[model samples]
Structure formats: C-alpha cells, structure tokens
Target: MALQPLPILPIEVLRQAALSRLRAGVAAANAPDADPSALKTLYIPRHRFEKLGPERAPLLHVVAKTDGGEGLSHELPLVASVGTLHINILLASGRAGAVDLDVKAAQLTQAVCLLLLEDQTFLEQFAYVEALRVSMEDGIARGDGGEFDVVLVQIELVMAEGQTQFEPRLPPNDFAQVDMTTDIGPVVGSDPPQDHTVRLRFEPEE
Candidate 1:
C-alpha cells in the first residue's frame, strides 16, 4: 500500500477560524429583542500556558493580557484535548450582559473542536479521537467592571494513537503547540447586551 501523507493545518489559521465561529455564536446568543446590528468587534488578549505533564496533569500559569495596559491578568483554567493539539482559554474579564455568556462561550469551544475534526486536513494529521477535553475553572474579575468578573477560558488538545479498525484509522501521535487569539473591537457598553459576529477560515499548513 502507498504511504499516505499526514494531514495538517496552519495553527494560526485554524485558531482564527475557531475564534470567528465563537464570536458568531456569542452574537447569536445575545441578539437583541428589537433591532439587531452586526457584531463589530472582539478582543482576545495574548494567552499563555505551561504544560504540567500527561493528559491527567494540569496546565499552570495560564494568563491573558489586555490592551488596557494593565498588569498580567489571570483567570480560571480551561482545557481541551483533541488528537495531538491541546487548547486552553483563560478569560481575564468580560462585560456581563443579560445573555448567558459562559454557556455561549462553552458552545464556541465545542464548535472549534467540531471544526478541527471535520476538517479533512486536520483529521488526516490528527484523527478525531474524541470530543476535545474541556474544563472551566472558577474565574475571578477585578475593577468596577460591568457584571461578570474576568472569565477564564482554557482548552487543552491531546494527540494519541488509536485503533486502525475504525473507519477513520488513527494517525501517528505527535505533539504540537499552537496559540489562538481573537480581537473583537469595542462595543456599546449598555444593557441587554450587543450583538457581534465574525467569520474566519482555516487553511492547511505549508
């Protein structure tokens, strides 16, 4: 049998696409009862994490930065594990509106996982072993912000080998690190929340 090439996607491209979908979901969930304007902006500060060990191990020092020129801010840990990619989101702070932002955010995370698995290129490289592992730790916020404290969203991706008997045979397990950052610009600071949407695409890695 001819050897097949491994499937892969540009980390940044995938991250952006996932972020866009997340924004869309958030907007849809928070649509106004009356006139609905397009979702204009989203801001995802630079986030970082430290690997603890294996799948069971916990990630440490996950942080999110804001353009507000504040000191390094931290949030609860969120983790996700796919084939080989582990994703985590740490939310620093957010404007609490009427909409269930946390639930919408979780949905956004799942959407990203679905996209990664459905994408043939990504699957080829890192087969969809199972739903990405997700965890949302208790978050905290500071300053006289709106409603919610800085929410922390964390995701972790794990790559592992699987049985070949399955229709989609598992590929070699390897580890790679990728960072996803999203920026939704300012929105009207009001009640009932504002609606915002963004579309993003993913491309194969070169």
Candidate 2:
C-alpha cells in the first residue's frame, strides 16, 4: 500500500484560529450594545501584559502556549496533542459610568463561554474540546494604576491533530522459514532421551 502523508496542526495555527473566533464573537456582542463602555477589544498581546496601560481596558487576552502529547505507542505513526487555551477578561474597576466590575466580569465570562460552545466552527479547527472552566480575581494592571477585576477562562482541548511528529515507516515483514523441536522424556533405565524435529516453509500471505 502507498504511504499516506502525516497530519499536522502547527501551534501557531491553533492559537490564531482561537483568537480570530474570539475576536469575532466579542465584536458581534459589542456592536449591538452600542454603549461607549461596552467591551471593545480582544487581542493576543505582543508585549508583556504588565506593560500594557489602561487604554487597553475592556480587553481580552488570548494565551495559547504549553502542551503535552499522548505519545505514539505500539508502532503507531502519530498521536494527539492536548492543551489549555486561557482567555483573560480584564476590566477597570473604577471606570466612570460603567457597571460594577464584578457584574461586567460575569457578563463577559458568560459571553465567552457561550460563544465557544455555540460556535461549531471553532471545534472544527481541532480534534475536540475537553472542557471549559472560569474563575475571577483582582489583579494590578499597567504600572501602579488601580486594580482591575479579572476573569480567567480555561478551555481544555482533549486532542488536537497535526501537532505530533510522525514515526518513520516500518520495514516490511519478511521471513523465509521456521524450524521446531520437541524433547521427550527418557525411558526408565536404558534410553537417555528422545527427540522430535520438523521444518516448514513460510510464504507471505497475499
């Protein structure tokens, strides 16, 4: 049989795929609200998150790094890679005319989880999603500025394809013949031992 090419999903591709879908979802939610304080931006930070300022508030940070694989076994060619994608929802606690930071965090977290669940296209990019979890806490943002309420959402992908390296092709099974022998018990006094032997040809099955 002809060998087939291996399947692979580069890490960058997975990260970007998730970022695009999330950005789209946030945009869709923001448009209808039409409120100046409504969440506006979702992005993958190019610099250290601590260096970012308050202007980046009402933002979502998508982090997709760190993963381990179900290593290949039994001479299998490939295996799945699994990991978590973290979405950090940040909002300024004291922004004027805005809802309570706690309320905003809950709303944002709900929207994020719903979008990821309802949007089937997102899952098409990977093998499958294992589960999603969310938590909230206070965090310092942008130098010594006021604390921002943060919501963390973790999405665990059970198995993603194309992330593992493929094993080299196995050599063909080729053997020509087999030989066998059996030892028999000796008689009470005279015979030391008895033996039986046989040989057979081996042919590859069609």
Candidate 3:
C-alpha cells in the first residue's frame, strides 16, 4: 500500500518558527560576554512596534512581517515568509559602542543561520530550507530615545515543513519455508510425449 506524505506546515508555523528561533537565540544568550544580557530578544505587535515603550539600550527584536506563498503547492504545503530582526546598539556613554553591537550582531547572525539550516529544531520543523536567507536592511536612529543604533536583519524563509513519524519495530523471522517440485508425465518427445506438468508445493517442518 502507498502511504501519503505528511502534510506541510501552515503559513503561521513557518513564519513563527523563524521568529521564535531568532528570539530564543538572544534570550539568556551566551556569547561575547562583554555584552552580557545586553543582547536580549524583543517582540512587539506588528501594529505597535513603533510605539514600543522604554526599551533598554541594547536589545534585539524579531518580527515576522509577511507570510506570502502558495499555501498548498507541489503536492505539499509550502510557505514563503519574510521577517525582521532588529539589534539595538547603545551609543550612549557607559554602554556598548558601535563596535560592540557589530560583534554581537555578527555572532547572532551566525547562530540564527545555523538554526535555519537545520531540518527540525528543538521539535519544530523548518526542514532544511534551500531558499532560506537573511538580509541586512538599513538601520536608523530611535528618535524617541537616547543615542541608539538600529541594526535590522531581514529574514526570508522558504521551506516545506512536515512532521516526523516513528514507526514500530517488528520481530525478526527465523522460519524459512521449504518448497518441493515434481514433474508429472514423460519428458518431451518421449514415448507418446504426454502432457508435462511441474508442480511446486510448500511444506513446513512437521
């Protein structure tokens, strides 16, 4: 019997996986100790990102901006997602400088890219996306706050997501069937050349 392939993930799952991984990467993240707890994850509602309250000097925000693709295609569910990850670098005194931010952002990018290349991450599926990529978009100043440098990471995710099935294990077969063959009737061109028949029967050990 032929089995159906697993269903592909919905658009939300694909987009959300991208966002979640990025956020999780920065949450209590361990890297470049000079910026400890400085490289934290940020999440604001799409409609209110611009209205975020007083955020710390150094913070990273990950957002899934758009989900656009053939919901169901290629006999499987596929999604094209675009996301944004912003790294806020503190430019004020007694805090991290542009160099520090650059180092952290580079480190963060490497970590997230490794995640994207994975087939299933921590029980979530984004399966090896051949078309996955991250773009560094233009950064701007946060006019509402003190000296802050904005670093944006434009995330593009494209992959067919599916679940994993663990099949049952079967016991080994130790019995081998024995077959017996017999010929009925004389050989061809023999006396009268009677009809010939070869019969095969399987018999188990008594």
Candidate lDDT (C-alpha), each:
0.41, 0.58, 0.46
Which residue runs of candidate 2 sit more than 4 Å off their true CA positions?
Answer: 1-11, 30-51, 95-99, 140-206
- What does the lDDT come to for candidate 2? 0.58
Query: How do the residues 81-143 of candidate 1 rate in per-residue lDDT, one tens digit apiece?
Result: 123334554333345435454665565556555645665654454334543457676544444
Candidate 3 wrong stretches, greater than 4 Å: 1-9, 22-24, 28-50, 53-100, 122-127, 161-206
Q: Score residue 92 of candidate 2 by CA lDDT.
A: 60
Query: CA lDDT of 38 in candidate 3?
Result: 33
Candidate 1, residue 147: lDDT: 34
Pitting candidate 1 against candidate 2, the one with the higher TM-score is 2
Residue 110, candidate 2: C-alpha displacement in angstroms:
1.0
TM-score of each: 0.36, 0.59, 0.43
Superposed on all Cα atoms, the candidates' RMSDs to the truth, in angstroms, are 29.9, 7.2, 12.3
The TM-score that candidate 3 achieves is 0.43
